[model samples]
Target: MNQNKLQSLMLCLLFYSNVSVYPVTPETIHIIISEDKTMLSEWEIPEELTLDTLESKIGTHDRTNETEDSIKYIWDHLGIVAKFSKNSKFLNKLTVFYATTLKNEEPKQNFKGKMNFFSSDPNQKVEATYKGWICRFKLGNRSLYGICKGENRNLEQIDILSK
Candidate 1:
């Protein structure tokens, strides 16, 4: 092969080898919530997804809701609060606050980050800025929530959900 062709071939092989050595991890979990603010799909956050890692992945501000037992980071843009337990050192809970009520009693087709948990819905520490529909579920708890997109509900992944 020509010198240029050989170099190109070597580069391709190197790229492919590296990719196989280190596979990319899935970052986002696609989910859909019902209009009533219940999770219609199942979502198990990976163990590696801690508060620190989350903040790094999705930038967060200084605003926080903290106590002796737990710490929460609220991302206004993402409309989600990731809660971590003090002793466990992992993301123990997730609460997603909606921006607006379901249109016509149905989940909105798109989440534009326009809505938030109603003032009354949030914990006292965050009530000042948080405000719409709120859905809170614990990770690895007996009660589980499913993932849905505000589109349809077949409940196909039933095994992942809790009774």
Candidate 2:
């Protein structure tokens, strides 16, 4: 009886302490970029891929949506969203998001100097490791509104534009 009561007390204390008992595992995607920061690629993926050929490299997307002008191919578990032109079918840009709290996403950054189109500079921070959070170095050609968008945030997503 005493042991049962002790265990129950311990469980109640832990639950009331506001401690997270379960940690979320993040989804990840890996990309290889060109030296000029204009092209994007991967292990088996080509430098430039169209909507029709994207699946041949990275496999089929989890879900997709389209507009008259553009199409989006999303891989939820892999944390990738490739956007392309509807007429040309050529890839316009791809986004990588990792923060799962807001949308249950995970990210893995494994770029070296001159490898990936870093945040305009190779010394910039790109991904949040399992140890802690990280910020995207530079913002792409997107609307910043008043402040720098995607700056100093936990790498929610990024647009890798094509040439």
Candidate 3:
């Protein structure tokens, strides 16, 4: 993605909403890091998202796949794939695809959301304008990382997964 556009996206992510982590009726979607920088969340998808609560928040999935150790719920229109351990109900991974169309075409109407990452502690600051920095934080009781992958200069996906 273009540098200017990436910066713009980060800005929107950080300041689009100021509500607490679990917003009841969100006006704008967002993922926010805790004030201390050790925790991160996209509460719309929440740390506790599971098989039981999935449909209520995201509606029905378009597809589902289960393997020996995991299950995946895919929403094609929303470009999200939520994963869970076979024996667990909570999300083990969440994938958000961004480059949904062909090259030179307009960006698809993706998850119109924002993200905010900040730290008040001088020793723990993270850059929101990172070129390829790993965004690391805690997701519930697990350590997690959010990574952005690209192809042909287009942002392809953001994967938030256990570390």
Highest lDDT model number: 3
TM-score of 1: 0.37
**True-structure lDDT of candidate 3:** 0.53
TM-score of each: 0.37, 0.47, 0.50
Estimate the lDDT of model 1.
0.41
Q: 1-163, model 3: which lDDT tens digit per residue? A: 6999999988887764422222323225455654423222343445566765755554566667777898777765455677788887788867655555522222234645555554455565443322464444443333435444443234455564431
Off by over 4 Å in 2: 1-29, 37-47, 100-152
Which should have the higher lDDT, number 1 or number 2? 2
Error of 1 at 24 (Å): 18
Backbone clashes in model 1: 17
What 10-residue stretch in candidate 3 is worst by lDDT? 18-27
Candidate 1, superposed: residue stretches over 4 Å from native: 1-45, 99-163
Residue 130, model 1, lDDT:
11
| Candidate 3: regions farther than 4 A off | 1-28, 35-46, 100-110, 118-125, 128-155, 161-163
TM-score top scorer: 3
lDDT, each prediction: 0.41, 0.48, 0.53
